[model samples]
Target: MDTPILRNNFKSEEYQINMGPQHPATHGVLRLLLTIDGEIIKKVEPDLGYIHRSIEKMCERDSYQQIVHLTDRMDYLSSHINNEAVCLTVENALQLEVPERVKVIRTIIAELTRIASHTLWWGVMGMDVGALTTYFYGFRDRELINDIFEETCGARLTMNYNIPGGLMFDIHPNFVNRTKEFIAHFKTKLPEYDLLLSGNIIFQKRMQGIGILSKEDAISYGASGPVGRASGYSCDVRIHHPYSNYDNVKFNEILKTEGDTLARYQVRILEMWESLSIIEQLIDNIPEGDFFAKTNVVIKLPAGEYYQKVETARGELGVYINSTGTKNPYRMKFRSPGFSNLSLLNHIAVGGKIGDLVATMATLDLVIPDIDR
Candidate 1:
């Protein structure tokens, strides 16, 4: 077939270009078959499974506590969010009620994780659009947050701090000072990022109106986090269904109606600020109480089904458990955010430039283990 000439809008037929199972621009193992006319793309098919770690099968034999660690590896950037999700679900099934202090702690860790996740995204967004400095600036703040996590949780990327009922341990006495310090330092640096990347001309040119995901399509495909909010869904789990102490803390869910790459980027950047504010409220009010809610080592639940949902940094994470009054669950299912967001890629990628496809994919921020499992 003769190569179809697509217009600059990328709505016409075009010759296909294989971008990668291994490409520098992908940031991870993502293979894209892009059909392009000049620089614009008419179609895109994302080939994933480059990093399938068999998480579901792995969880079948592992203990409930052990599965928390496994969830961490699934979304490596948002490890605390992943840990909180599994913990919340397991706790709910076991009918374990965490203390006020514990809920506050979980909220703190999850929100910090959200900031870290978005920081990673901010850096990658800049890199994808051809600005390296913005990437460095983002990580510079992230490193401080990392240091705080490492001090308390004993790990940075995959902390696995949350157990079934609550945290593995109480917040370190120094947790407050370190958190406040990082917040103060990070707030000072946020404006610098705005000046560097969010306000940059090149970024606007690359992102504005590019890889636009309409409001309806974003919702239908189960897009979450910034992707859904950017489309004006007002669908944040934090607002609609408060988990942990999220209801206690007050914050606005960042939103934009554009549903394009720029809207996604803007929503995320704005959210980091809200996350910071939420932390400020909880930092002082964290009630002094027990950390982990005690549970039997050999967990047994009545024969029934229990479902729990938590707002992860990425989106809604639901864990469905079927119990048969046994040592282990009869069945367990994780409704992962990465899977939903990644599933919608083809819909948005159909009429964008090969490069825009990449920009769009990065915005989704897929972590493959969740999907493959």
Candidate 2:
């Protein structure tokens, strides 16, 4: 037989389009193959691995001290938190008790990392949805946080500040004062964020009631962070599995039952306020003690498995290590929240407009390197 031409039972008006491996809206080297009919989406298939660095495989060859830096590359937006996760896991394996000062400082830095990540997301989200002014406003606030990070960690984005036992170094002398000033300034500016984008009638019309992801679907997808919380799923790792000084802090987990794009937006906005509150509570009272706990230069965990989880800007990041009593891990795996959250994209995007898909993905706050890693 030369060929067989099969006739379709139904002729669809739908067409396939590639959203990116480069488009800014997909947010960092994500390629989405979208099937659409007259502006309404029918299916979305994400093509990843463009930026794969094989971080897990890299961890196997690097020493325990050297591996900490690789986590920074996965979620650069939550770099500090990523660093802390590996440190926490290693410390737990070794049964090392980090000092109170270190815990408090780690918590503060993590919150600051959250705010900075959110700030950038807000800007990019606004631009994705056609609001240019919000981008400027978002970055303006984020720069302050970057300055603070630079002062303490000596790098703005991929700061590998947390080591196995504790911090790489003590907080700078001006770190406290600068952080306090940022909080004071941002409190006034945050309301403007609402007025600029959240209050806009166009934005409200575009986002509200769009891309609805129900609570059950969120849980099934393993969505975490603001995305899960927005859908009324209480999957906050900080709340369920308290690490560092998270248990000592008084802050609400921002939740919204609507499970729409607008609900996701509100969750992050509220979370920013909670992060601010967490920072204010600890900024002044950071205990006086050694920042870095004593650890041997050569670290080799006993032959066993170890895991530690922490709440990042996007969601829970769990660092898992299998040690064969070697300086390097036998196997290392990172449970990045972005992968789980991205899985639900096609589920929620179908039946909605492309604009709605963009809005929903924005709320998910995907950092693509996390997915490929």
Candidate achieving the largest lDDT? 2
TM-score of 2: 0.96
The candidate that achieves the highest TM-score relative to the unseen native structure: 2
Per-residue C-alpha lDDT of model 2 across residues 109-185, encoded as one tens digit per residue:
99999999999999999998888998999999999999999999999998999998889889999999999999999
Q: Which portions of model 2 show Cα errors greater than 4 Å?
A: 1-12
Weakest lDDT window of 10 consecutive positions for candidate 2: 1-10
Clashing pairs for model 2 are: 20-31
| Model 1 C-alpha lDDT per residue in residues 157-258, reported as the tens digit of each score | 889888887888777788999999989988989888899888888788888887788889988998887788999888898889888998888899888999
| lDDT scores in order | 0.82, 0.93
- Candidate 1 regions exceeding 4 Å error are 1-15
Total backbone collisions for each predicted model:
1, 1
Candidate 1 C-alpha error for residue 78, in Å: 1.1
